[model samples]
Target: MYELKTKENDSSVIEFIEAVENPKKREDAYKLLDIFTETSGYPAKMWGPSIIGFGKYHYKYPTGHEGDAPLVGFSPRKAKISLYFATGDTKREELLQNLGKHTSGKACVYINKIADIDVDVVKALITQSIEFLKETYPDQPE
Candidate 1:
C-alpha cells in the first residue's frame, strides 16, 4: 500500500513557523496563520512537516486511492510561500487576477510574502476553497 506522507499530525504549528530560517518568512507565516484560521473558522493544524492547514476533507480517486487533505492550507517555503487552495473553481483565476503579485501552479499559489498579495483576496479564496471542498466531498464528516 502506498503511504500518505502528508497526513495531518500532532505537530506544533508554532514550532514549525519559528523554525523557518528566514525571519521575514517566519513572520509572514504567522500572518497567514491568522488569516487562514480566521477565514476558515478552523484552528490551524500541522500537515506534514510545514503545511499549516485549516479544516479537512476526505477524497477517493476513481483508482481507489483515498486520503484526507486540508480544505485550505499554506506553507512558508524557502523560496516563496505556497498557498494551498482547491483547483477547478472558476472564480480562482478571477480572484488571482486581483490577488496582487503571485504565481500559481495547479493547486498552490506562490507568493513572495503576505504584503505582496491582497489579504482580503486570500481570505476570499480560503472561503471558496472550503465551500468547494465541502460540496465536492459531501460525505466527509465534519
Candidate 2:
C-alpha cells in the first residue's frame, strides 16, 4: 500500500500554491482549490510531492494492483494544470466537449488556465466524477 505523508511539515498546500512563480497561475490554483473544496465538501491536501488532492479512494484491479488515490485533484504543472478524475468511463468524453479549451489523457485533464474554461461546467464534471467513483468503489479508502 502507498501511504500519504503526514500533513505536518514542509510544503503545505497554501505554501505550494503561493510558490507558483507565475502570479496568474497562483491565482488560478487558488480558485481551483476553492471550487474543489466547495463542491466536494472534502478538505484539500498535498499528495506526494506536488498534487493537491481532494477526497480519496482505494482501488483493486483484477491483476491485484490495489492502492489509494484521490477522488478528484489537480497539480499545477509548469505549462498547464493537470486535473485528475479517476473514473473516466464513457461519460468523460461527453463532459470534455462542454469543458471549453483543454486536453485530456486517460485520467488527467490539462488546462493552461481556469479562465479558459467555464467554472460551472468544471464543477459539474467534478460532481459527476465523484459520484461515479463513489458508486464504483463503494468500499474505497477508509
Candidate 3:
C-alpha cells in the first residue's frame, strides 16, 4: 500500500508563494498564479506543501495506482520554478518548442523565471493539458 506524498491539501497558496526565498522567483510565482488561474478557469489551490495547483482529475493506472492530481500546477523552487502539466499529451511537446528558455522532464517543466518563457505558450499548454486530462480521465469528477 504505497501512498502518494503529493495529495491536495488546504494549505495557503499565497503563503507558499510569498515564502519563496528568492525575490525574483517569488514575483514570478505570483505571475504564474495569475496565468494558470486565468487559463484553467479554476482557483489556485495548494496541492502539497509547495505546489500551487488548478483543477484536478482522478486517475487509476493499470497497476492499481490511483490518485487525484492537479491538471496544472507549479512550484517556485530555489534552483528553478517547476511547472506541472499532464503527461502523454503530444501537444505539450509541440508547445514546449516555443516555450522559450526552459527545460522539461516527463512531468515537470523547469524555468528560471516567468520572463524566461512565453506566457502565451504557457497558457496554451495549460489549456491543452486540461483538455487532454478531461478526455483521458472522462470518468473523473469535474
Candidate 4:
C-alpha cells in the first residue's frame, strides 16, 4: 500500500504564514487565506507542512489507489505561490487563460504575487474546482 505524505494535520495556519521568511509573501498568504476561505466557503486547514487547503474529498483510482485531498488550496513558496486545483478539468484551463501572469503545472498554478493576477479569476477557479471535485467524488463528506 502506498502512503500519503501530504495528509492534513492540526498545525496552525496562522503560525505557518507567520513563519514565511518574506514579508510580502506573508502578507499575500493572509490575503489568499481570506480569498480561498470566502470563495470556497470552507475554513482553511493546514495540509502537510505548507499547503493551506479548504474542503476535502476522498478519491479512489481504477487501480485501487485512493486518498483524500483538498478541493482547493495554495502555498506561498519562495519563488512563487502555488495554487492547487483539480487536474484534467478543461474548465480550469479555460480560466487560466484569463488569469493574467501565471505558470501552471499538472495541478498547481504558480504566481509571483496576488496583484499579478486577477482575484476574480482565482475565486472562479476555487469555485469551479470545488464543484468539479464534489461532482466527481460524490462520496465526499459533507
Model 2 clashes, total count: 0
TM-scores for candidates 1 onward, in order: 0.97, 0.90, 0.97, 0.98
RMSD in angstroms between candidate 1 and the native structure over all alpha carbons: 0.8
State the lDDT of candidate 3 residue by residue for 50-87, as single tens digits: 88889899999999899989999999998999999888
Superposed model 4: Cα runs more than 4 Å off = none
Which is the leading candidate under TM-score? 4
lDDT (0 to 1) per candidate: 0.93, 0.84, 0.91, 0.94
CA error at residue 136 for candidate 4, angstroms: 0.4
Name the weakest run of 10 consecutive residues (lDDT summed) in model 4: 133-142
lDDT value, residue 64 of candidate 1 = 100
lDDT of 3: 0.91
lDDT of 1 by residue, 1-142 (tens): 9999998999999999999999999999999999899999999999998888999999999999999999999999999999999998898889999999999999999999888889999999999999888888998788
Per-model C-alpha RMSD: 0.8, 2.7, 0.7, 0.6
Model 4 residue 14 CA deviation (Å) reads 0.1
Candidate 2 lDDT tens digits, 113-136 = 998998888888888888999998
Clashing pairs in 2: none
If both were scored by lDDT, which would come out higher, candidate 1 or candidate 2?
A: 1
In the predicted model 3, the residue pairs found to clash are none
